[model samples]
Target: KQKLVPRRRVLSRSADLAEDYRITSDNVLHLVLKLSDLNLITVRTTCGQEIEFLVDRYRNVISLKHHIFQEGKGFPSQRA
Candidate 1:
């Protein structure tokens, strides 16, 4: 039997654009943010720059990382 890998659904604009990375207002990711355990995820770059994102409890760490990546924000290599 061949190995099977799950493919993540890619978000697009107007159901046509596939690989657009620009974060526009209409293409912004709308994650569920008002769950029981809402948390603010803050990412700090090497140069002391910080960015914040709101995520709920149900999302896994990988999903958070994926979100950051999907939004074209770029993830930090080292954790602080």
Candidate 2:
């Protein structure tokens, strides 16, 4: 066991480097939400009737409109 204690770890980048210093000890839950998770939001559409949609965040209203068109609730998507 003593012989192995002085040997360099295979996974380590260098022998001089000890424990992993770059990575923090903070818990994952403590960090801000993921980009994908942040995008998961609810959207309400009222074309004629009320409709709720769980969609990712869009850069603009046109993108949301495009998404609605793709859903095929009423009008068919021209672009597909």
Candidate 3:
């Protein structure tokens, strides 16, 4: 599996968000979401021995912000 580190902090202008970072790995894929004034961009990639990145964008942003519901998964569990 590959790990996706959020890069939202490095974004200055909406145009700068129109880039994609590649992540090549096993059965796992990371989808990075970039928001634009009119739409959103989703960059899907995998991870390898070492992480890699590429410039890419999506067609819609609203779809990426959709609620992700996971069954049987409650809020963070309290530590004992």
Ranking by lDDT: 1, 2, 3
Name the runs in model 3 displaced over 4 angstroms: 1-25, 40-80
lDDT (tens digit, per residue) of candidate 2 on 1-80: 01112223333244533344333344121222335522544454443444455555646777767766666467433453
Best of the two (1, 2) by lDDT: 1
lDDT string for model 1 (1-80, tens) is 12211133334334544334444455545433333577788876665667777898788989888866765455555655
**What residue runs in model 1 are displaced by over 4 Å at the alpha carbon?**
1-35, 71-80
TM-score, prediction 2: 0.27
TM-score of 1: 0.39
Q: TM-score rank, highest first?
A: 1, 2, 3
Model 1 score (lDDT)? 0.57
lDDT of 2: 0.44
- TM-score of candidate 3 on Cα atoms, chains taken together: 0.17
Clashing pairs in 2: none
Q: Provide the overall lDDT of each model, using Cα atoms, as 2-decimal numbers.
A: 0.57, 0.44, 0.34
RMSD of each: 16.6, 13.5, 18.6
| TM, every model | 0.39, 0.27, 0.17
Candidate 3 lDDT trough over 10 residues, lowest sum: 47-56
